[model samples]
Target: MSEGVTLDRTGGLITLGAADTLWADLMADSAVPTASAALTSFPAHARMGYVLLGDRVVATVKTGSSQWSVLEIEVRQAAAELNAVEMDRQDLVRIGPFRSAAKQEPMEGTALRWRQRITRALQERGGLERAAREDARPYHLAGIDWRRILVEQTRDRTVRTWWLPRAAVRVLDAAEHTETQWLHAARACQASAVVTEPSSHHQQVPALGSRPTTSPDCPTAPLRPYNGELQGHLYSVLSRKPGTSRRVAGWACAVCRTTPATVLDHCHEHGYVRAPVCQSCNTQERPDHLYSNDIRVADHYRRLFDTHAADWLRHWHRCPGCRARTTLPLPHLAAWTAHIACRSLRPTHRDARSSRARKPCGVLRVSWTGSHSAPRSCLLTVAVDFCPSGEHRVLAQVPYREAAEQFRSWLAETAPAVAAAAGPDRLDDLPTRPRPVIADTSSDGLALF
Candidate 1:
């Protein structure tokens, strides 16, 4: 087995210490000179070195019949200049007539002395003449030039000692970058390994006949029905499968889908379960219906009062016996019915009497035509009034049988006038036949004429 020598190929120059004196001397005398000579001969490679204080090199010269030797060359070089002199340690060796002691320590070591001597000889030979021609590029550890160190280490069988450049080493050592590279490599290797695996016999089994395997990670649940309007609540309904029970959870309006329903309406009158109703319908529709129904009843009473007033006015040529006006109230059947019903439901008789007294009576005023004016016509203005006394009174009296006969004839003749007076827009609404009344109570029993 060959013993391997360790080489520091970590880039840049490695400084040597006192223990390395012999090694430094040998390297200085042999390697440094050889390298300098090569660079000088090429004139393309740049070469340089710093001189130390303690090491020396022995050079032999042959004289006639004997060997001659000289000692204490005391040569030192730095900043690429060389000269010989006696010097103490840390001497500024290049550039001056100044003695070493004046600005620097005295120069030491034979090797450093030899280095100075050789450096002078080389400089005198015009070594720096090629400095401008030689490439002055700087070496960066991150760049390609450092790879040469690795190659050298590999060739010397010292690969383990080799390392990438400083910057590259830092990147490789980072936890995040290392983890990313590891994951990428692992995924790639796993995929490749899977590709290399042999196919199994199980793949030949029929897929249709295989027992159904439910994925353990995703369990199936039951479905639910949607009962509310499709708005904000649609998503919650769709998330469930159909035709299955889900938690009722809370109440919501079935129609509008607005929550916290305004009213729970029971269809007790129609015989069904209670259902949620929205505020808009609850607050508006119920009251409106009652109002409309009252209007219908009020209209009937108003028509009766108007008929009596018209007949009494025509018969007596004045207002009625009750001292009521001849004009009739514009019939608001709904309000009249509501007023009456409200009165009927009063808790006490006095309360009912007060309500009735407050009830509105129908009346009208007539502006009749003079004999020279348009034929048999008058302008009728109806107004509603309330009586202080809660008493019902008949304004005109005639035989009931006779009043009925006259009203029928009068209604027939006045139907067209009434229809026309209602509005030209409503002329199309004229009834084809007369609406019949069961009785007329305007004559003897005070029927409304």
Candidate 2:
């Protein structure tokens, strides 16, 4: 071994103690360099400066700011110059005639001594070196276990030892020319890692023959149809088998045509899928009662098959219900009626009951509008608003007969005085003046014409 710290010769590698913070700052800088313009040289006065020796990088930073500069240099040449002189252990580094002392304990190992020596050499070259002697307390180089030291191989075929950092640490080397390039590469890699897309294991759309018990748009809870036949029809229409022909590739709702068909609406009575419909049409058709009978479902299917016979034959070999091309029976219709009649018996068919149970009690508002200002416009709008809780919302609208009935029933049960103030005779024609009735009523009443 040489008089100084032995350098590993197998690969051009070296070891030195570094402050965890300085090494962290370098790696961080490697990840993200400030947007500030580069400076030509170290400023006249620096708040704090540190010397490290792995790749030979010297960092000078402003006291309270993130602004910093890292410098790399020839380790062999600097270490040689540092060994030329002999001094007491108190000496940290020598800058020409000026010398700085370790305030606590003198550095023992050759690596640390070389670092101190090189730091002073650079300061001397710049003519802004540390004063005659360091009066500050010596920083006990943090103990880094050799076993845990991270060895990183650079592209230049040179391996370097990175001191393990508990937190922000010191640096151990200098190589100024490559500092900017290294930082840029590190940052690019970090950015790429950050923006990489994450993979999810959950499937949104199911394969053919497999039914999804949940809708993608609303994922709060899963949807489980009451009957197996209903579930099968839902799966066939709502999902597609891989590689199947897509007649309605960009198909929109048949009823609204304005919105995408996300919900698979079916006849509640026959459990037969009618067609894809928007949420609005689904709500509207639920009250139609036109498809409430088995005969009606069969008639509707016959009409659909007759109109799109070519499309039906292209996808399926025969009618799904009867499994025969000649005559189609209403097997789904029977399943639908059976499911509806015994729905309350199933444990999973509790969504409707649960929803109704959660309905809150609040206020009511009614509004009526005549024709608008547009030419040849004949629009009469009637809407009813109800808020059982503080959240005011529109309960119903149009013809206003159903809304009026609901309002009257709620009024009679909760706040009868408000209903009496505005008599039933004027229900069609809301009173011009606002009625003052129950002051502490749970619901607020508003009537506008």
Candidate 3:
């Protein structure tokens, strides 16, 4: 009981162990006394980290409020014990035996811009003096070993802080070589999730008793043959012994977890297959230096709305005030009128670069294509007196004039001002048929006039 242990929480019970010593942390928050004083007096926090075996670290997160369900008890070796070499140049004072692996000359137009960015970076780190002195050093054929360096790389505002050991990584090069130490060290940090056990857990957890850097043997299935442009290079780097198609496909797309992986997405700057991605995610374009796969995330939302428009429309109810089918719930006349007016007030645009869609008449109104008869049309059509954006439902055709009268009376009673302005004239002015135009037809059964 004196030694600390790693812990995993399932529902109300906490499973505390690493090397097999079980303990528990329960949830009772009334200041009651218990046998284990430590558990009773545990501080209220979302996450807890503990040290075990002097150099190993374990962590858990609270997943529930009432029961304090701590989850994903993971153990990691302390970075210090690896005799990790610090590679940051901020502390260095001399040019001794350190240089970039490859020559990178800025193009004609970018020379000044590149120099300015470099200067700003150097100034921030207080390394301008060291850099100036290093420029005087004679060119040498020797290159620094990237394996021993500890560097911080930044992409998409998320700073990746890690140590790169050469033997544990592999990256391909322009010359079709998979032994480039610099490229491997640069991109190996993004490897796809390799460990899957304990069905509920979705993260990559290292196998118990295995070194943190060592990945388990690839699956037994035969490797898939490559037929792409980089056949030789891809096979050499990706088809290595510990790599397998089953293993890659077993992992979800790194950008969007909902899709199974089909493409090995890598950093083009350095040939490292960071993770497996879906076709949509791998092909999407993004701005330079922003590598967080925001394009894939955007596409996810786009497809969600585009594919499930009908499903979403089901949740909306007709507004009594404007009879528009909006995201707002029904019977709330004031709110519905306000929502329509606000949407219609927004400026419209045709520019592809605009973030917001141009809604010429912010209202979302639907039309009745069931009948051309006045009474029947008024009862069934929602987009007739308003913009076409409001049509979001399928209605059964009705010949009853009472239904039309009831809707008109409800609209006038709910919003007197709007009804007074768009009164009988609007209803009487309803178009019998939509104009013969390209925008008249949509798969959703809603058309814009």
Task: Return whichever of 1 and 3 wins on TM-score.
Answer: 3
lDDT, residue 321, candidate 2: 22
Please rank every candidate by lDDT, starting with the best: 3, 2, 1
Tell me, by TM-score, which candidate is best.
3
For candidate 1, write residues 81-124 as lDDT tens digits: 11121222121112111122233334432212222332342334
| Candidate 3 structure quality by residue, lDDT tens digits, 304-422 | 22343222222111111121211111111112222232233433445455756543432323222332222233332222123344433222232224443444465455544434544
Candidate 2 weakest lDDT stretch, 10 residues: 440-449
> Candidate 2 lDDT, tens digit per residue, 328-425?
12222122222222223222212456754433233222222322121012111211124323243433233323333333454344334433433434
lDDT of each: 0.24, 0.27, 0.28
What's the lDDT for residue 313 in model 3? 21
Model 3 is weakest, by summed lDDT over 10 consecutive residues, at 170-179
lDDT of model 3 at residue 349? Answer: 42
lDDT of 3: 0.28
